[model samples]
Target: MSVMRVAGLSGLILSRALAMTVDFTQTESIKKGAGEAAWNMVRYYTGNNTGDTPGNLPDPYYWWEAGAMFGALIDYWVFTGDDSYNTITFQAMQHQVGDNDDYMPQNQTRSLGNDDQGFWLMAAMTAAENNFTNPASNQAQWLALAQAGFNEYVSRWDDADDTCGGGLRWQIYTFNNGYNYKNSIANGCFFNIAARLARYTGNTTYSDWAEKIFSWERGVNFINTDWQVLDGAGNAGTENCTQINGALFTYNAGIFLYGAAHMYNLTSSDTWKQRVTGLATSITTTFFKDGIMWEPPCEATACDTDQQAFKGHLARWMALTAKLADFTYDEFMPLLKSSGVAAAEQCSGSPTSDWKGHSGTACGFSWLKNSTWDGNYGVGEQMNAMSVIMTQLLSEAAAPYTSTTGGSSVGNANAGSNTNSDNLDPAPITTGDRIGAGILTTTIIASLLASVVLMIKE
Candidate 1:
């Protein structure tokens, strides 16, 4: 009995070790996992240039969701140095853009919303920044497309309105429901693209536009004193009607965060630094439960498709801020790491989950570590999980493989050396995590007990 007990205990320990051991050192593997997930999504949603079939995306296929998925693929290519997906990226770009590949027509592209157009432009900007070589054209062509997109936004800026003084409308279409809605997402996306373009091309025009947009947002009180970005105000028939809507969203925070990070990196001004830190603090305090992030309105119930997709931008930009801004990295790493690990654990047994670095299905939508899936698995869910995994993998790639004492290190490698001393582990483990560990132990023990009984009978 004593020997059986020891054997069972050993089995349990092995199971725990297997469960906990994720290879942070395997950069290629990590990139491949993320990249493949994006690839799988593209295959399902996007098809060959042979024209639109029942299986393929229809002609002029440019929407916010499709743009985001394409952006994820481009990010995967840039981060991993894998060009295998570049052909697919450009193929979609060809389908969406005008004949010159620079002008994205509102009619042809069906880009009714400024925010929707911004998403595609941002992906183009990323490709230009990374110098993604196109077989059909050059990097200059990609830059031209980005500039055209920017020019489109500049043309659409509604300075004539007295409500916010100056800001873009949610939709360029007059008949759209959100036409009267001056949303943060529109301005935030505009701000981010402007900042990124400024950094990429060293164009003061882009920076100036970014500054103007930021001021407009501040003026409207959409971005409050606490750095919490409210949703937006609409029906502003007059300046007196400038009451800002207070509903918060994660993507709004994310867009501003990344935009501010870029501007800070560009100028290194104290003001930008303060803005970056203030927004970071607000995001952590407001959106996170303990250390994991949740969309507040959607926590109790399943998030709508768009809301379900919102958190991915937050995850991506927060991680980007950590990578680009040294001052905020320490502050942001704890939540990023904890949430990332929890997300990974929660995703262990997801439908079509390809966790073993092999071909499988994409990850599920809910990222609350243990939240139940809302039964809507689509491109958005795939993009969200891909973004998080890519961010975590990049964090791992930045850390040293081994410690000075040669001791096996745990936690996020980029999370600084004196983690304990820094008191970064403020996150309380979720009950789900504890229950998950307990289940693993019980399963291993039961299997070992059955084996021991068989031996005794023999």
Candidate 2:
């Protein structure tokens, strides 16, 4: 059958499949996809034989990819009650901690460009603490490694003179590249990792550092008067290929969302909630079109570039958006599935096709032949996107329901109150809930609008 015909059939099948059952057994593919994606990422990062050419080894060995994958694995295990995903994640952490040779000897003590390593370390630590029951589970070892890596990252910060305000410098280089400009995405990741570490270890120092960096980024470089993030404060007018001037990025936005969500979880502060909601709303309004999100230009001229090329970033932001929006499994599931499937389709015949690529590995896929960008295949973008998607999916699947006091409930406080027909709030969604409900809602609304137009025509 034609691709369009297949897509149509898949859409129909997805629409009808989850209407009746609320159980997780009904949506095992999402869980499995997340697990598989995480495993693929770990394999890719470890340079395992996936029958694909390896992309350029990421500086610091792409620990963020590993961290995010493990994070997703934890989320998957929580939702599906599957121990295997958790087991693999634990093993990956052990590999990182026990095998000191994972990093090159020259790169080991150098923390200058180690932003991703810290982020991934924290992710592994969180997973180990949450899942591992035995002392040999190495939860403590992973946490220590993450904490040490964080300390090394902290040392790279120039406290005396806040050049990029108070945020950490972009990287540590032996010979000065003279570029001290802090990147939004990197700082955002640092803030997120620091904040989570603070909460995990009961240490206020890490949290304070996270807040300081977040404040620095918000106050100095990115945040506009309306609190929207600009790409950066550096090189305002001149066009730089590496620096995308004044444009907001979906990945950067996702990092901020992750930070904000963690902040909200830690403090229960309304400020964090408002910021997250505003950013999320801005993202939905500005970049999202036809259920796909697009990346903002790295430069003014690139603004008109084909939006389809940025699907990886969109997928990442979508997962973050779902988390912040508190979307139920039923609501966001189809979108997740569609996004994953679409992205996977893009890399289907390429060398990186073995894994989801977008979320499971560190590289970029070759753009289609007719596209503007180079078709050079890599897995970094795909792996980054997949990690977030998987993490969100698993988290939703594993969330526990709490009984609502003085309410007719199935012991799941998040389960929508069936009686409040006038209340237009979508069902309460936790991180572990499936995205099916949100997708269903979107479908139903679209169908109704179509029917209304048909009636008017008749």
Candidate 3:
């Protein structure tokens, strides 16, 4: 079936949950499976898997990868409040920083790349600020590392253009071509990380950088008329429509929207607020259909090389749109829950198969034929999906606008209660705290097992 059909089927399957609890347990098992799949991919990177796996490499000390997983772990901790998640995530951040005074060299830092590192830095800063008082020294260290990384990134990439215009290039080539392309994704990261740092540090410089970059992006690259992102220079006038390579990148738009919203929170800038509203409207009206956003129209889709890659992008975009639109859990939850249910129903019994590059067991389900990149799912996609879902839940529970009003007296009383509850110190996770974690753990394991069995049967 087409992803659209699958998405439609999902709505039917999950209609009942629209008015019910938005707790993790109430979500579909497949959605949870997808979340576990993301975490498992990180587990592989962290050398936390069971077995003395022969191919296992030492956990990455690189900043970008570490930062991505750190962000994912923070999302996990926030959603499940599992202390182990916090502990493991903390260790991973420290690992990236290395031993005292033997810190990883600047040359090795990945923030210079202008992609994953910026996003990861934002995530790390968020975690550090949240947990600042609990583990003062560790929090300080993470924050310091992130700040240093940001400073280095700015020095290397910030050009002479306005803050928005002169952000980092998509990738830094050591080769002498100086062919750095200004990309939407990288600039989006700059906006997000800089704004986040500003909030945490009360530094106007970071906020200044964020505001400039965001304005530049909207005014320059983003096609306000159609909401399409333009490829730079040579590809000028052309909308980016390729996956991973900046055409219709959902994550790029997602990060930009999120950053714009957060910046509005920091400065209450009408311009930033309008940017968020405009982008959100553009995304909803342009990309979404039958509650699923189609993946970018890539050469792969045209060549029929692999449809799964497209599917991956579609899922990511839907998750992102749901969050940025600030769709109440009631309105947005069905998109994922339904998709999982449809997958489960369609592949009830089939031969279990594996996609070539994707880790973990695969199911025999095939949504698109003649797709070359079919079996090669990665940790990145899963992590993106998990983060989207968790963020959506948190966004809903917190009622994002509550903060905007400067007080709890607003339209959402439940959210006000939640805001108060969140302000209370999170109790240390112990035997008593295990109940919630146990539920999440059980749900994840059970979902994975079910998916494997379903794939095998199919």
Candidate 4:
């Protein structure tokens, strides 16, 4: 309806005619709505073709958030069949796979945590599972990149040495502040990737790792019997991870749930299915209110840049879980449907729009407020909205590919640094990190020898 046609229309008729933001019943509507929301999200991205960075956003956004953004973009291409953002997504993933082939990029060394690196692992895994075009044969293959990150994480697994039985530390670098904590998102990411890799490669080792993580979380009480996914706990020797943080975040729940769903997919065992049932139910109980998805913990005004992005992850993995576990489709779809419309309704905000009659397209954080347009905007908000809306197309979308089901990305079992041994562990290492102890010892010995020779000459 154009401005001219707006004239003389009855209020009720006009209201009924206009879809709030999207109509899930129509595939075209879902695609159009998701595409518009994604385009608006891209407007915030400055790393596409300019001199900034191929996959990075501007200052306010962090590197890992960029990983999450590209992950969403991968899903966008999958759901809507749009290739517009593929180049940048590919460039970003490739550029950030630091020298060791793990996602521990040098530029983000100080800030890179296991969780931060895990987000990018998800993007690569998403590409492989969805069959997003593989990179040039010379570049890191998607499956291998995911495997590399997984390998590095496995190397860093806090086994006999660290706290809370076994889990990835929140931060990889010992100098970082959170090194003393073991968080669910970091370990959950490892578990999620492990499950998917197991399915994608027919590798039983990854499945074993996945099962171990699930057991550790439950055994350590990071995941309670009710399946409530808490945030983190203190490091091993210090707190023994005896005190769980108990804070709830959608991403944490989604991450664990996603991995569990894949576990059920891979093993048709009753044990995995029961675990999936518990986690999926927990997703709805903890994150959703009567079928509408919202971040109960942070959405009520305290969502930092990172927290604002959590709901989108929940929405995305929920749809994915539904696809992988057919039994979950019925329970998950209602949440997806309700949240998609709610999210889309808040997307009707832009600077140019007049409050009176015009509306523009920029997503907001408060989807529960719906149509009221929460007046907040950023990459997180946009990704959240887009993730919810695009997934509404799952009814028409194909199921994700498994190893025997058309997956084409090559794999390298030893992709990341396998350096962490009996007493050595490293990650998000600085640019100069070569072969660790050998290079450092060699340099030290050479200096000592040169000093002795100089003293003899003197």
Report the number of the highest-TM-score candidate.
4
Most lDDT-accurate candidate: 4
Candidate order by decreasing lDDT: 4, 1, 2, 3
lDDT of each: 0.61, 0.43, 0.43, 0.76
Which portions of model 3 miss their true places by more than 4 Å?
1-35, 46-66, 98-112, 132-140, 157-165, 176-179, 231-246, 299-376, 388-392, 395-458
lDDT of 3 by residue, 138-193 (tens): 33254555555455445545343322335455544322121234567667666776
TM-score of each: 0.74, 0.59, 0.60, 0.85
lDDT of 4 at 125: 95
lDDT of 4 by residue, 1-458 (tens): 12211231223222323333677888998898888777767777777655776767776678889999999999888888889989878888898888777787778877788888999999999999989888888888899989888877787886654466578878776556566667889999899999999888888888988999989888888888778887776654446777566677889889988888888888899999998999888778778776678776656645667777888988999898898898999999888898888888776654332122223565667777867665566678878888999888886667778879998888888777554222334334333432242233344333323322110001
Candidate with better TM-score, 2 vs 4: 4
Error of 2 at 101 (Å): 12
Clashing pairs in 4: 163-236
Alpha-carbon shift of residue 95 in model 2 (angstroms): 4.2
Ranking by TM-score: 4, 1, 3, 2
lDDT of 4 at 200: 86
Q: Which stretches of candidate 4 lie over 4 Å from their true place?
A: 1-20, 236-238, 352-359, 418-458
